[model samples]
Target: MGLWRVFYAGWQMECCGTPFSVGDDVSWQLLLVPGEEPASRLTGPAGHVAGATDGIRVVQEAGLTVALSEDPEPRSAGAGPADPGPVRRSGLLSVETHGGAWPEVTGRVRSLHIVVQDLARGADGTWEPVPGTRTLRETDRCPKWFRGREFGTDTGRRRRDEQGVLVGLEVPS
Candidate 1:
């Protein structure tokens, strides 16, 4: 069996996503993201032991309708505006890395982790996660997305953990 940590974003769940629980068999499009990416901040260490999957430690649950944007780093230094690419409503999600296709992961949920984080006002007047305020709670039921208006983002409270779901899945070889 192969164990993997999967990140299911709250916003994705709130936006027409089906909720799943522990022990449920599921197939989801998984994006292989580098550990240093911004979105990887929400995930735990990778558990899959595939040799070619290095640097793809973090996997995110990709929605059917995904928003595409131009690669930010490759833009010219003086580009006037960043062009947000057209929305892809392909109803399919997948990624290819190292000349291999990683379309979806089929597995049984072994465990669920709800990520909780404590937020503090940064010097720049933005809410940032406290250095060590991250914790995970084991749960069986999928999370419900709570709308938060304070920071113009969902789960806008100082101390919140009910938004993100980190699923531990066991894939059969």
Candidate 2:
């Protein structure tokens, strides 16, 4: 696991419904599932907006992926509509891969994007999607092999909407 210091510019964010602001000194702990490793520093970026500051994508693993600061754009799959936009990844989120049980990160709801899909499995081996969320038309909508349950910060990774149930990931801007 890796540790990181998060900096927000008072953009109005939350973790699992708990509101927070700049200078909060939130601790971002990055944990990778089995066979996973950090592709780069926890403070390094995976990518950035067309021309914005480059952000870092944290731990990378085969089963689970986590990124700190990056940009993710989720598109509509089949019946799904266009992704409203990428979420601001001031906060990091990630999920266990390989269809294993991943405990939801307990925090305030991220204001930017929700990183979950419709066919996600809970830590208890249940097919649970974000509440009120429908299934994704296909896996193509997600980054690489991630199912619909993947979520990231507004800057890093993909999209989905849920409270503290967000997952941080990395991909192209």
Candidate 3:
């Protein structure tokens, strides 16, 4: 079996399950179920926002099947890069798990280490890179993905009011 890591960020943002390691050319469906009350509370008031459940539901229901391989490689569409970006710091969030069917034999995503990446500035100048870490605040709109492909794509969108502040760091993966 090969290992695959899946990440979900945004509203209802707790990471779920362990990294899946399965056989080659295999396809499986993933069901992203609603988290329990304790987990939901951890998300705070931001979890009550509009479309939050829908987004989470999509990730939950869109089960992923892995093609087992002697060589380790992911075969899912929309899968981000293994090395997503530059690593600015250590000790971010990470989770591990054995490969298997959706919603079955899955493990709770504990406090895994992640390398948080640094935020960058845009041409319109809405966000500026600040030094040090702050709480990730809840915003009127959903939190921004700042890095990845979505950055700078929609310049006219309004910024969301931040709620909880998380210390920002840059990770290479």
Candidate 4:
């Protein structure tokens, strides 16, 4: 079993994700993001995002296919109806990246960890986790994202649903 640290975001869960627990067999669409991407560091300053937790592994790295749409533009662009085209094997994995669906990774959850970080906007307009405000809470269930009055409304200081699960998943071969 290849153990890897996978970051699952909170909004992704609240949108189309289901609550999962340790030892539960689950499948999720995953995007292989380059570590250089600023968003990739969602898991802390060490590169943690407000809602990303680590700890996912892969069984195989190849032999995967992702469904893609031919038209990359928005439907409102007067591009007529959208077509989901055909499924193609993603050899480079980075070929034709878009905002839609991604390849699904399936596996059993080996562990779960929730990440909580208090973030404040800096003078440079970048958000960073506050000192001593980063904590990883061990949980069996993935929590849902919620919007509260105290969230993102305090003069540059606000609480966010930046909680996520570190699912140990098996990337399809």
RMSD of 3: 17.4
The model with the greater lDDT, 2 or 4, is 4
Best by the lDDT measure: 1
Model number with the top TM-score? 1
Q: Give the C-alpha lDDT of model 2.
A: 0.30
Q: Return the TM-score for each candidate structure.
A: 0.54, 0.21, 0.22, 0.52
Per residue, candidate 3 scores C-alpha lDDT tens digits across 56-154 of: 211111122211111123336787433212212112121113323222213322222222333445677655433442233322222233222223434
Give the alpha carbon lDDT tens digit for every residue of 1-173 in model 1. 76656667676677656778899998765554333212322222222224323222222222221111222224577775433333221111222222322345678888987766667567787877767767778889776674322332463446444546778767775
Q: Please, what is the whole-model Cα lDDT of each candidate in the order they appear?
A: 0.51, 0.30, 0.25, 0.47
Question: Compared with the true structure, what per-residue lDDT tens digits does model 4 show for residues 80-147?
Answer: 44443422222111222224444455667777777677777677877666777666677787877733
Candidate 4 residue runs with Cα over 4 Å from true position: 36-98, 124-127, 146-161, 170-173
Candidate 1 local Cα displacement, residue 126, angstroms: 2.2
What's the candidate order when arranged by decreasing TM-score? 1, 4, 3, 2
Q: lDDT by residue for model 2 over 43-107, one digit each (tens)?
A: 22233223222333233332223443323444345554333233333332333222222222323
What is the descending lDDT order?
Answer: 1, 4, 2, 3
Higher TM-score: candidate 3 or 4?
Answer: 4
lDDT of 4: 0.47
Better of 1 and 2 by TM-score: 1
Residue 7, candidate 4: alpha-carbon lDDT: 54
By the TM-score metric, which is better: model 1 or model 4? 1
